[model samples]
Target: MDFEQGSINISDEVLKEIAFRSFLEVLELSADDKDAKKLKKNIEIERTPDDNVIVNVKTVAPYGKSLVEFGKKIMQNISENIQRMTELQVSAVNVSIIDVVEKIEPAEEEE
Candidate 1:
């Protein structure tokens, strides 16, 4: 799933969908991050001259293990999503975690 060229041309619509989907998936994985509890978020994508698509995902994670898990999810989702649109080999999916979300509060339970 490597885009040897470094970047691939995709429709604006596809890009938008990818961004949105990627963001949501990240959000779900980082649900425990208190800082990430903020409903508002954004994701940015850029194509490098070499043909590599750089996905800058801004979100929060529960730290440590959760962070790693979120990263794996990002790669899988992006790779699978791109494949669904076209058979282009994506050189790489670069994900940058911009914000570290605050820890989430545990839910209360009744006896």
Candidate 2:
């Protein structure tokens, strides 16, 4: 008699969590902050029956020239990182600009 063990199965949820954590590391985000962590963030991941992965990421950025450049840089970095790190074929990484954050003004101190 011969017996064979089944291969390990990886769930999509697990993959998404892994991807999200990786995103944080690549983006240099504060992973220590539970609220700031991508995995814990409002991002959503969907997997098609054909094994294609789709991710929609919503991020807030301050309105400025540098911030615009940084946002673009972040998007590129995310695409590259996902491809390099995951075995699952990524169908697309869609970024939606839902909100713009204004720069915070420093409060004046009274002597």
Candidate 3:
């Protein structure tokens, strides 16, 4: 983006942060989730010659969830959030499901 003064550039770290947060939102995981920190390391952002971004995300899908649906949700969420927040175009969102783990349910408190 450009202004009368100069152009605005967003750093890759910021873009990655945006993408990660959007990814977590779709998965309904909090930043404090046991795997959040490790999962964050799997997000990567690349810039294209056309000045658009391509996001590559690797994550473990919870068992019992449809992998296709899960990947679509993540791709849509990340693309929307990044474009909405940064006004940058997302060329593509590539999601890689690395593994599947059983869903962990929170324990209920005893009455």
Candidate 4:
């Protein structure tokens, strides 16, 4: 998708939220920083005057997963969604792995 004349302007925070939510749908992962302030540092959005945006996402993936393929999926998902929603071309989407988290099992109730 593409836009001309710059009729619309979107906030960086909104882009970040879009990215964060998109990532969650693509994979089983968690962001390193849960707080809004810290999250800002993890997700970066660079917007060009031409309506092209570059997104950077840092996250903790589920253990035992392939980082390379995982990152690719994240980038593809974010880029596609952004273009579909805002009609803005995503110049690039970068994914950074901060750490990997183990899946915790729930305890069984007494029978």
How far out, in Å, is residue 32 in model 2?
Answer: 0.9
List model 3 lDDT by residue over 1-111, tens digit each. Answer: 899999999998999999988987987778776556566777899999988999999877778989999999999999999999999999999998877778622121001
Off by over 4 Å in 2: 1-8, 25-27, 66-72, 103-111
- Which portions of model 1 miss their true places by more than 4 Å? 1-9, 29-41, 48-52, 63-65, 102-111
Task: Give one digit per residue, the lDDT tens place, for model 4 in 21-101.
Answer: 677667533544243234444668998787689998876666787879888998999999988887778999988776766
C-alpha root-mean-square deviation, each candidate = 9.0, 7.9, 6.1, 8.0
- How far out, in Å, is residue 45 in model 4? 0.8
Once fitted onto the true fold, the runs of candidate 4 whose alpha carbons sit more than 4 angstroms away are 1-6, 28-41, 104-111
Please give each candidate's TM-score. Answer: 0.53, 0.62, 0.86, 0.70
Kindly provide the TM-score of model 4 when superposed on the true structure, using C-alpha atoms: 0.70
Winner on TM-score between 2 and 4 is 4
- Report lDDT (Cα) of residue 100, candidate 4: 68
Best by TM-score: 3
lDDT of every predicted structure (CA atoms): 0.53, 0.56, 0.82, 0.70
Candidate 1 lDDT score at position 69: 73
Report the lDDT tens digits of candidate 1 across residue range 1-111.
337778655664566456556555655535454443332234455666765555555444555456777777877787677656666445556555544546522221000
Query: Best-fitting candidate, measured by lDDT?
Result: 3
Clashes of each: 20, 0, 0, 0
- Residue 76 CA displacement from its true place in model 3, Å: 0.4
